[model samples]
Target: MHRPAVHRRDPRLEIITEAVERLIPRATPAHLTVTVTETLPGTANPDGTPHKHTWTGKPEGLAVKVFTALFGRPRTEEQRSPLAQAEDAKRARDLVGELDALLAGGVALETAPWYPCRPGDLVHVHHRAVGDVPLTPAFGETYIVGDAGDGLMSMQLLAHTLPDTVEHAADMVGCFAAEAADCPVYEVWFEAGAHLLTVVRDGRPVHVGGAR
Candidate 1:
């Protein structure tokens, strides 16, 4: 059985969340965009507010000033308008569709945060939480696509297979292991695409349905 998850707050991320919570005027769009700085870039008043808080030489908006007080000053930051970000995501989804065949060929894990699910190999997974309460499906399943040995596996996601994502999704919170199998070797669907997800049973590959 999977153990319940534990969560802790990150002080740095909290700086932004708290500023938004305390200072954001109610009715602010859920998608409001603002540029902020960790650096106040000016003298501080006795109470600590910067004497000359500004952005790129111009005075900062209220949101920027609030964040500036929390973070020293950012070296670089960018906030695209929500609509623009949405458009980018839409285009990206289309692009992923176009490259389905290529993506199906293989997968790799990001170096620093590689998640391991080898029986008895323990690892910590970062995921969303509400005041120490982890979100359900906190660790979404990984549907492993193939083996890369030395504990690295090319995985995907679904309940019974490897796990839930073809790749790491922004909100994936859990890892999955099969109950029992004889080389699953099956087709699996990912966001707007499909690919083969194969599993080895007792050191052997199970090829099926035109898949190797």
Candidate 2:
């Protein structure tokens, strides 16, 4: 069969690379076969296009272990008790509320330094956390924002402060923001659950009220 041309660099490939590196950091590819999922623009007529497939990369072992360390392992009915199940339901809602509260008054994403994402229609974001906001963790730490429900938001930190001479912090004075002008930015808290809510549709960053 005739297969159409594929992009030179698949972002899923990059994600797999990043995930592996984030953990192993240095490892020779020998027998490592990873499985990744990709959404492609498929044949369309009147219905919708559905061309979703998986890229091979184990998405298991280390990455899964690390991810689980941050976000607990998903439980099945056989494994989880009824009380645990009830708690799990409430936990999902709690996490959403906590995430919302954290990013309640956040500014645009591009305004931040070293965001993992960039602007465009095909914005690439492999969220570190779950729920509405998939904020990245700090130092692979487990953080608790609200009352800290089972520490669901733990391991990954969602809030960060942009560096500044007049606005940047001491630690962020000369780093992180260097590439802020070049990459697409996802949503970032104005300053850790303090600023206003603003999602960036356009590449332009909105830097109006609030400060980190």
Candidate 3:
């Protein structure tokens, strides 16, 4: 069973989330279902370490149709607006190129302040890409696509969360890892046109779906 989530606050988290919501136009009640939740600390991987505080949630619109069909829920998928589609694609490519540049630049964990919700700290940002879907189904769901590092993953590696900015996102760069920089695989998704979602670690400034 999934354990109950925790609650905490970070200024950066709020900023990023607001940015995503404002920046991405498709994440409306008419288009998606977005849920932001905080995760409690727990056991680490086999390396015997403590877990980190985490946050995760789905975007507002992508799965409305499929999810509703699968579970008899309401139909909330927006009309598949052309503007939304175009915007999603452009953002996905932009994010991919941006992350690639960060790696190429040799940037590291020193970019942002360490997340306050966990034991360890920011390490690096690992990135993955998924193609031709409603959104990048990285980590098993849709999200604004981006890479993450181990400092963010120590709690629950590969967990997904929405975006919130607390004045720390612009500075975040490169993938982080506590054990192996490329150990556990991460997934990211991009819709055909106007949306890109990435599920990165909490307190690390990596948020899924588009942040404004």
lDDT of 2 by residue, 26-114 (tens): 33333445556677675543567666777554433444455446555422222221233335556787765445433322222322322
**TM-scores of the models, in the order given:** 0.21, 0.21, 0.20
lDDT of 1 by residue, 79-148 (tens): 2222333355567786554454233222211111111223322221122222443223333233444554
**Winner on lDDT (2 vs 3):** 3
- Candidate models: Cα lDDT each: 0.31, 0.30, 0.31
Error of 2 at 2 (Å): 21
| CA RMSD of all predictions | 17.4, 19.3, 20.0
**lDDT per residue as tens, model 3, 18-116:** 344444543442233345445446657567766555434443232333334555444234322233334555688776655543342222112222212
Summed backbone clashes in each candidate are: 26, 23, 53
Off by over 4 Å in 1: 1-36, 46-112, 120-212
Flag the better candidate by lDDT, 1 or 2: 1
TM-score of 3: 0.20
Q: With candidate 1 superimposed using the best TM-score fit, by how many Å does residue 47's alpha carbon deviate from the native?
A: 2.3
The runs of at least 3 residues in candidate 3 whose Cα sits more than 4 Å from the true structure, single-residue gaps closed, are: 1-105, 115-129, 133-155, 158-210
